[model samples]
Target: MDMTACNVCGKIFGASSGSVCPSCRKLLNIVYDKARAYLRDHPKERVNAVDLAERIGEDERLVEILMLEGRFENRGEDAEESDDDKKRKQLLQDLQKNLASMPQKQHETGTYGSDRHGARREK
Candidate 1:
């Protein structure tokens, strides 16, 4: 049994993981609901963690924790990746995979300058 202090209410309790205790977790769920509702109504508008916390009357840390837990995604304009960047990333990954799959040739025997297996012959 792992013991921890709740991040929300600062209560001591037995928790396997995460900082919030069961009671606070329940309360945080309610907070999540309110935040989700707010987002739904104002889908076009942008809100930072602090602003969202203020709008829902919840702690900013709780809003951040929910975002970290993937309850919601922060799709700010600055965080958006370009399609060209995505394509370039994919192309780089493909090149790396192809390079890794190719068989490696032995360059030399025990000596550094000479090639015994003809893997790299000096002209």
Candidate 2:
């Protein structure tokens, strides 16, 4: 049978429903912090899906998925949660986003943190 390495952990396993294994699949998140920061710091620039994705090293589709799934955008006003749970979720999502903007150690000049990298990245 064919096998693949999980994106999150260096584990050899069969490819499953998710892109990565279950462990790392949870980690496939969006860089909302950077996106939000950019939007705030440069509101006049008008950040959108394309520009935001380019800033990182992911496609617009992938980035969108991250944000929506990450729950960065507040959905329901009536949504209730424990203060601790809310803080933990928010922190985790933010941390994931921040890390998403960073490239792996193997990546050099054209991996992330540059809009150019997105265009140059292999499809």
**Top lDDT model:** 1
The RMSD of every model to the true structure, in order and in angstroms, is: 11.1, 23.1
Off by over 4 Å in 1: 74-123
Q: TM-scores, in order shown?
A: 0.51, 0.30
Q: Write down the lDDT of every candidate, Cα atoms only.
A: 0.75, 0.59
Give the range of the ten consecutive residues with the poorest summed lDDT in model 2.
72-81
Residues 56-84, candidate 1, lDDT per residue (tens digit)? 99999888777777776753222343576
> Number of backbone collisions per candidate, in order?
0, 0
- Model 2 steric clash total: 0
**lDDT score for residue 2 of model 1:** 83
For residue 79, what is the lDDT in candidate 1?
A: 37
Instruction: Write down the TM-score for model 1.
Output: 0.51
Q: TM-score for model 2?
A: 0.30
